[model samples]
Target: MKPKCGIVYNGHLQSDKFMVQLHWLSDTAKRHGFEPELIGNHRLIPAVIDGRCTLLGPYADYRPDFFFFWDKDIRLARHLEKMGFRLFNSASSIEICDDKSRTYEVLAEHGVTMPKTVTGPLLYEGFELEDVSSVPSIVAELGLPLVLKEAYGSFGEQVYLIASEEELIGRLKSLGAKPYVLQELVASSYGRDVRINVVGGEAAAAMLRRSETDFRANVTAGGRMFPYEPTDEEKAFAVRCAELVGADFAGVDLLFGPDGEPVLCEINSNAHFKNIFDCTGVDLAEAMFRYIRSVLYAADGSRKGDAPC
Candidate 1:
């Protein structure tokens, strides 16, 4: 019997990009002899009671052997896990990657090389910064023209470049008590960065994102993508970064250091692959499915061993 799997996506997000991802993943699953069902989070309700998960609605009794978690709905992912559905990236991995501050804490503990970052204090409602005096000292430590990023954001949407003490303070005040990160801006990597797709503990494809107009090199921010050949050291660094985060597949962004060495920028567990596909013509869904089969069905629809790579 062909193994059945579910490709979980954010159903409420009605976008072509989301549909494109589903199409690619479902097509790949079909080619690999697996029955792929598109599970939209909006239509499906995961009812939990006393540490038990029950499915309600169209998939009331249907259960898949595995799940390809392509959404950021962490609670739903966890609920599925509790119901014995194995998630590719896992719920814990998604949670960590969803928050930049937590991502930094995890990677730093593993000694991953990255820019110096300071996690900001969380601001609650009806509260303000009690000590505004430390703002200058933080600027002094990270220097001028630092990068400010919200802990929870995607597609470089909530990132800012603060050039002066006044600008930094102003932006900080505007941000209020939201969790953020202040980091040293790597001058060499301005308007440029490398994104490597790592799957099954190896680097598969890489693309260089460059933008002359915006400091952020995200393609969504009007950046251009060019095929990149990563050095062995650079590839190793990216692979290690993904492994540390326990991501079965990830898009790891690496920034160029002052001496041209690679430093970790960020890791995306549910990375959008449309740009990488257009640039490299490498179908990420195919690679992901291959990895899933090797790990989940190497022996009779159950993981063969502890070997994740």
Candidate 2:
């Protein structure tokens, strides 16, 4: 019998954007001899009864061999893991990558080349930020035109570039108690970056994102993507980043330095591969499915051989 895999997604976010991912992943899983099932978090409830946490829902009676976690629901992911479901990216990896401050801390410990960063202090909901002293110090350290990124955000939505002291202070005050990070802006990579998709410790596909109008190189931010050939060093950097984050598959964004060096930007465990496919004609879902099958069946004496390309 084929191994059953559950693809967990946020049912509340019923946008077509996320649904497309599910369709691709499920189709790929079927081609690779795995039974794929879709389970929306909205439809399921996680309950802790008698000191044991487990899921209760329409599909609660059925447990898959493993899970393909595609959502950022850390609590639900952890609950599933507690129930002995092996998540592809793992709950721990998702938690770290979902928070920029945590991701930076982990990568820094691994000696990754990243921009200088300072994590923002968390504050209570009703608390006022009266300590304006750190504002000047942060500006002085990172210089003007620095980037302010929320600890947990995607699609470059919560990132801001402050060009002046007034803008920086105003933005900080507006942010309230939200957790964020201040980082030195890479002038050399100002509207452009490369996103490399890595699976099972190897770089699968790469594309260069460019935004002429916006500083953010995210395709959602009106950036255009172009097929790009990555150098050996760039490929290695992306692969190492995936391994460091303990991700079975990941999209590693790299910023170019003044001397054309690859500088770590961010890692997305549940990276959307539509843009890369449109630009590079490579469907990373296939690579991801193959990687999953290889690892899942390697030690079970049930290897199904190579998946069709």
Top candidate by TM-score: 2
At residue 63, give the lDDT of candidate 2: 77
TM-score of each: 0.94, 0.95
Q: How accurate is candidate 1 locally (lDDT)?
A: 0.89
Q: Which stretches of candidate 1 lie over 4 Å from their true place?
A: 299-309
Q: Kindly list the per-residue Cα lDDT of model 2 for residues 51-77, writing each as its tens digit.
A: 988767787676787888999999989
Per-residue lDDT, model 2, residue 121, is: 85
Relative to the true structure, how large is the alpha-carbon lDDT of every model? Answer: 0.89, 0.89
Q: Which residue window of length 10 is worst by lDDT in model 2?
A: 300-309
